[model samples]
Target: MKVCELERSLFESFPKVDAESWDHVGLSVGDPDSTVGRVLVALDATADMVRRAHDGGANVLLAHHPVYIAAPDAFVPRSGSHPQAAAAVFEAARLGVS
Candidate 1:
């Protein structure tokens, strides 16, 4: 099956494993519009994940965790960055494109 299809199917099959009642988890990105030349599998999404995806020649990221939740106001990103920016920063860039 295609990657997106696989992602959705996998998420559906084991939603709780990838996430908990208080956690975020699911396919964050990977639209059909995406070229998807490469994929970066990560534990979390961060600016560093973006850089890692780019460096590893991955244009797409297949994160095990999900994005967007009910209480986002409490977990804001570092500026326009993603919530995982604090951890992604370990390998992310200052531009915060992630």
Candidate 2:
């Protein structure tokens, strides 16, 4: 299945509206057009989780917690802080984690 298709399926069941108004839900990275044969579900979208998904041959990483709280531009590379968020984005981009 494609990433977009999986997203649709998930939304059909979970329904993004069920999340709190302040919650950040749904796809956090990668491209929806990409093909996804396997999926890894977790509570957080951390760097290690991203790596695990890639190593496990999964193309999508679905999480309950928000991966990125601030804007993508706010996460400066190697800024000491926001390391996890930055790494998450980098790994997702490099490995195509959606």
lDDT of each: 0.54, 0.80
Backbone clash pairs in model 2 (N, Cα, C under 3 Å; residues 3+ apart or in different chains), count = 0
How do all models score by TM-score? 0.51, 0.84
- Tens-digit lDDT string for candidate 2 (1-98): 78888889989999988988877777778888888878899899987898899899888888888887664554334356655788787788877788
RMSD list, candidates in order = 5.7, 1.9
lDDT of the structure predicted as candidate 2: 0.80
What's the number of clashes in each of the models? 4, 0
> Model 1: runs farther than 4 Å from truth?
1-3, 16-18, 30-35, 67-98
Off by over 4 Å in 2: 72-79
Q: What would the per-residue lDDT of candidate 1 be over residues 33-73, giving only the tens digit for each residue?
A: 33446666777676667777877776666666644444244
